[model samples]
Target: MGENIDVVVIGGGYAGVMAANRLTRRDDVAVTVVNPRSVFVPRLRLHQLVGETHDAVVDYETVLAEGVRLVLDSATGIDAATRRVKLAEGGDIGYDYLVYATGSGSPSPRVPGAAEFGYPVATLEAARRLRSVLCDTPVSAPVTVVGAGPTGIETASELAERGRAVTLVCGGALGPYLHPRARRTARKYLARLGVSVIEGSDTTVTSVKRDAVELGDGRTVASQVTIWAAGFSVSGLAERSGLRADAAGRLLTDETLTSVDDERIVAAGDAAAPSDLPFRMGAYIAGCLGAHAADTVLSRIAGDEPAPVDLSFPAMCVSFGRRTAIFQLARKNDVAVPFYFTGAAGRKLKEFSCESSVEHLVNEARKPGSHHWPKAGKHRPVVLAAQRGESAAPAARDT
Candidate 1:
């Protein structure tokens, strides 16, 4: 055999781990995963971590495939011209190919005093800190959760279920991604848990103080603890390395997930913006993109053209505490439909999804190239065509 191809995957999140494991399909490829933490973190379960229900970490030994080298360090930058990744702890690792999968983190809050007083629960470290703060505060203390996204809702409901006075502030509609029907159901469940739901155009948080939060409507809510789940943002590693990235810091790539500036480099998971359009950030999408990225690398190795990504979102599930949940079904294009499942069935589905996500990684580690996802037709091309003011090709239509 020829010299082994060294493939370095930055970030050991779902995408990086899956990409690293799938690369094992080629015996000639040597995979090395560079991550800050030794343990794998299930980002979806971060709220549970804050509520003291789960730790939100897994052993890499159980998820990473055998023979894959795990480097317990963070990637400071990528020197694409030299095919090396700079490490935070010093030194660099040379690679024949590189996968960019640095996942995401809480955006630097812009609201006045939010940076000083608000607590974000997007990443593992943030969740741990929030958990610590909650432990010290009395259960009777008023807690205000900002943002109506899944993270905000989950955190608010989890705390409310624990008998804490919780207030969920939605900048606009509750669960913007959920269908109206699903949104109503979610509101009902949250109310049943004794959560005060605040929604409307004027519900935006103007500022966060140590003991209160001011809303746009000029109302100051008493919040002994403020949890910020506004949204997530990717690291600046790509832009820091002089690579092109979208406004949100996601590394820009072609539809095949290959870096536009450097074909030798690919991106996956939440850190990747393909065709300037990224999939919804989640473990499920990350795993699929990871596998597709590995296939692109393997194709390059075999001197074949890599195929474009073909996957679809079927449903989105969010839990209300540990008992009730909502599963909003969507079309292949990811637009939510009126149909949804709630209550016991929804709870079971949400749990299954969380467990199956981890199981998918373990399965891929045991069997490389075994991961697969349903195709959503050529919807992206059609959408892009429409954006360009050009007629869509017949083949781009959904079948």
Candidate 2:
């Protein structure tokens, strides 16, 4: 056998798993996936965990390729100069190529008393804890869900369907990325499920209490339980390791997904900012970037220039309980249009998208480069500029 290329992927989220699987396309590349957990957390169904409707986890044996090695450990640091990753348990992995895919998690809330009083739903343990709390709490308890993004909306609606009193407090507009029609559809379904949708500038949570939550506008919402789905925050390993990263700790990379400061290191999923513009955090985008990141490594191995990532959002789906949902069609640039599917049709589509994401990962595990996605035409300029080593263009804040 020829000399093997060691590719170490940090994180076992959708991106890491997909990257590990796809890296098997190369016969000379040995892939190792490092994660703290043994099982893959299906974050899409975490709300179902809170509702006790589904188990939001799957064994890595079912998702990861046979050629991939699963290391149950966390990456504590990275030494880009040495091409080695430090593990929390105590060893270092030397890699010819490294993939940073450590996904995001619920941030420690800055709001007064929030961290002490609220529950976050970004990981397996968090969801399991929240599910236990929900199961123990009385059905008639007042539950306040802070944030109106997909996680918050889905959690609130799913609980409401279970007969819990849920109030969805939006710090801003509900589903701000959704088109007006899609937003309307979401609101209708939420209202039908008896979820109180609180919006406007005053809806921001200022403080959390034992039995209530205080709003910025001096209003108090009665609640026996509070679920904090406000937003996700990535790991600080990149920033701490002196890797060039954005303010949110996402490693800054070129359009080809290669770290701007280090050609030997690439990044994927929510941890990667390509051309200074990170894609919206979701399973769909994560799976795509995972494949692209692997491709970049393969390109380097083959002595060819890695192609810039080509990606587009065909649609974004939001579930409003198990019975209803909203699938908002998007342009290539990911702007939600008026066209959408709602009710049961939307629900089915949402379900399929979730299922297909895992299926895509499994297929890639078995078939290597079996995954593919549409290209965004508008991203051409950005890609060209990145390849030319030009300055980064300003990015709009969407997700």
Best by lDDT: 1
Write one digit per residue (lDDT tens) for candidate 2, span 259-279.
988889989999998867788
Model 2 ranges with Cα > 4 A deviation? 380-399
lDDT of 1: 0.92
| Candidate 1 clashes between residue pairs 3 or more apart in a chain or in different chains | none
Residue 169 accuracy (lDDT) in model 1: 96
The lDDT, on a scale of 0 to 1, for candidate 2 is: 0.91
How would you encode candidate 1's per-residue C-alpha lDDT over 128-243 as one tens digit per residue? 99999999999999999999999999999999999999999998999999998889888899999999999999999999998999999999999999999997889999999999
* Candidate 1 stretches greater than 4 Å from native: 391-399
Q: In candidate 2, which residue pairs get closer than 3 Å at backbone N, Cα or C atoms, i.e. clash?
A: none
TM, every model: 0.97, 0.95
At residue 236, candidate 2 shows an lDDT of 97
Residue range with the least summed lDDT across 10 consecutive positions in model 1: 390-399
Residue 63 of model 2 has an lDDT of 96
